[model samples]
Target: MHTSHAHTLEAARYAALAREDHAAGELRPLPNYALSAISACCRAQMAADVPDTTADLIAVLDSYKSPEELLREAEQKARSEQEYEEQQRAATDMDAPNRAKRYRDVGTATQVIPQLGWSRQMVQAVEYADDGRLWLDSNGTARLINRAGVPGRVVASSRIRLLRQAGYLRSENDSEAHLLVTPEARRALYLADLHPEGIHRDDRAAHAARLKVALTRRRGKQNARNEAARLPRMDVWAMRHADDLPATLTQQREVIEEQRRTEEEKATEKVCTDSIEEFAGRIADHLDDGWALNFEQNPYYLDVRYLYLVHTDGRKLRVKGENCGRDEQGAALPAEKLKVWAILPDTDRPIRSDE
Candidate 1:
């Protein structure tokens, strides 16, 4: 009749049902029953009345999740259990083609990789395995490591699946442990000391093939070294002249150089043919502050006869502007370089801020 004891019995009954259904291979309804059982457990701990209430128990039970949350958590646990069971089954399945070839000592599974065409990553994976398994060292830079070994190249985790697809990891893997390589790959890459097991060759021919692979690898490496040694010393005979290189490359160089010369030539001519404004502007630097300039030109020659220095507080000064010479700071500049406004030849104008 007690609510907590009654709910506890209910929980036990539901749990028993779940376990029985799971044993009978009828798992679909287990999470629903599991959720019900957990709800009962939660209610069992809630204070039914003050007499039965303990503050800690009541507070803890108050923290119980809503029904929907409890259901989701049960479903998630079920999924995890299902996955774990599947992995366990796979681990025990001795007849799987991938695992059955585990102990092979020799013979290529198939001609999957091309001759000398193994990528550096693939070769390193095979080369740096520990025992028969490649393990990870948990580090940012030290990825794809072999235990206690020098750091291996950072191969992507996805590359493990590729090795499985290739024949190198063609055997010797536990269900989810894809890093365990086959004996043949281990012997060829690491040990070179395997007498075959149940899967493949068990003789002199296997050892000879392994040696032949090693020899081929060395010869290829030597050939690469020879070519590398010759590379810097050798020059391309076709690229000896501008025309000998590709026309587009020659044109690119010519285009940039031509742009440089075009601007440079204008700058060179600028020294001789400066605008009259630019020539007159220089005189301001030599003039004291508050003093401005104006000019009137000769009728036929490129020269001014009347040039005035006007002060802001109403004062005017005149310098004889005909054929005058100046220093680098525009001191006493000649009249020819200072006059351009012939339209106002008779009028003297103040050089305001707008000028």
Candidate 2:
């Protein structure tokens, strides 16, 4: 009849009742407040049942204001049991959806076999054997490899050379190719293979579509501008007496100022023009009122200047043009070209141009 033992039994009873409510499909967890009251009641009830001295048993029951309060407290304990079970049901149901998206080839070793003897190191086990020949294991099961194979001599040499040219591989040996996949490459390959459709293939297709649209729009604008610039002048009278028209100082001054302004504007436009134009259309498409445009004047060249544009609350774009110089660390930055930027509230800026 110790108070601590009474408390332990009371808490255990609540736990057992909660489990029963879970079996009955009730949806919540037992709260601590109700359990404390249940413990106090158990202590009082046990004191009476133990056939202790009449004064001690009466004193234990008298601790409560009335029998009604004790009964009401017990009813709250039952409600706590109901609530505890409800919470457990909710958590179990929530995990079920995520489990389906995860593709785990567990337990059965037969389903997954290590890929071997591939001609290329980049070939992962996820890719099915090509050319109707099982280049992987001699066992001939569709080798679903969770990893990439080692690069052979041809892949080490020629394939590495090809990869460097395509900007996929870089090594100390300019001529000698190094055929090894880094841990980052392995992870990328694994993630790409995990999807229903290959990630690289989907990305490549989307990139190609974007490139096609960009090229088309660029060429269309260029063609239109060229056509306008190439049109014949309609001045037959000026051609007959070209030398007679004396130049006025005002007109000459006006022409000079116009030329200077055009040169400055062109210089400013160079800094961020290409990078901005390429990605600006995407930003403009998504926002209203649009981004801001700015330019930087190069100290070395009077006519040469960098241009930049910043969207009020958008991306932070960086540009690197042909005129920019590398730092001591061999890092390149935008200088003569336009470096367009979009302002974002957060620390992580949108760098769509580079990555």
Candidate 3:
């Protein structure tokens, strides 16, 4: 007898279901006649003719194997599939991070802007700013000119204004003349290999040089204004002590010298006071031997004062001092009789009198 392909396929499917039932322990202790029918069904699958009905197909499957045999086969097949999956997962875990990093490093504005539906020219214009901001004129023209003295791509103004409306860029000031790139825009530009001001994304030296030049210019302007303000004060001082201006300028010299000395003395005193108190408290809580303040001395003039600390093993450290004296009102008192000194732990040498 011959069977059609569909009938053969159907018989195989019924056999598979019976096998699952056995594996699940729902079918057991198969009868001999059923086992024989199942075997006959398996053989029929190789031939053209096989069972035409589902019942006949299932009856044939029952003849081939007992429930216990079917269950064992199912379990073995499942174990093999699980092992294959675990191997695939382990391989993926090892390669995932490096793959992700490579993906991130390859991003460029040309590639990213297209994804956001923005034109390449817009990104180019934004990248022209050395400071991540673009300034425009009343006519919506960019205020900055390139090295060749040509106007920038002000035609992209419409696109920039649209982007600002969409929240990708923001007005830097009230004039609506300047736009700053928002973080989102900067990130997109970074991914696209488009850096502002023609600067290389990773060129730290070039970036620092530009920053230094800007700061120096600002400082120079500030200094000029300060010198202008001080000119009248200088004239008045010179008039008050014409003789002293040529000889020693003793009063002016003393005022400047005292101001400098007082600042140094206060700083030294603060460091010594904080270290011996606050730092020592935290250290004591953590160490078994701990630390203790040994002694502190106040100086009247020109000699070093001391803050001493003792460790568990009897080692002593002289930590800090102050030289300038202050009256009750915190005014700078005469320093003619006061002395200050300290022995630093790192060098174990007394601080110089002049220092």
> Which candidate comes out best when scored by lDDT?
3
Error of 2 at 80 (Å): 17
TM-scores of the models, in the given order? 0.17, 0.18, 0.28
Worst lDDT window (10 residues) for model 3?
A: 230-239
**TM-score leader:** 3
lDDT of 1 by residue, 1-355 (tens): 4987898899899989999999999978876677777777776877354243335543454456578876897899999988876684466443333233333312231222222123345446665454444554443222444466544556565444445554455433343232555543543342122221211232233233434554566667556544322211111321122122112334556889998777655543322223344544655655677778765443443332345567788777654332323435646544444433321222454333123
In terms of lDDT, which candidate is stronger, 2 or 3? 3
**CA shift of 105, model 1, Å:** 15
Kindly report which residue stretches of model 2 are placed more than 4 angstroms away from their true locations once superposed. 1-162, 165-167, 199-210, 213-355
Give the lDDT of residue 119 in candidate 1: 38
Q: Which residue pairs show backbone clashes in model 1?
A: 102-172
Q: Give the per-residue lDDT digits (tens) of candidate 2, residues 1-355.
A: 4765665566567767767767787735533333444555556556646532335534564564477877887899999977875674465332322333222311111121111111223343212222111122332212233335432212123323332343333333333332234333333334333432322233234334334444556667556444322211213321222232233345557889999888777766544334445555544444435555444577778644443455666554433332333333434444333343443323345434333
TM-score-based ranking:
3, 2, 1
Backbone clashes (count) for model 1? 1
Give candidate 3's TM-score.
0.28
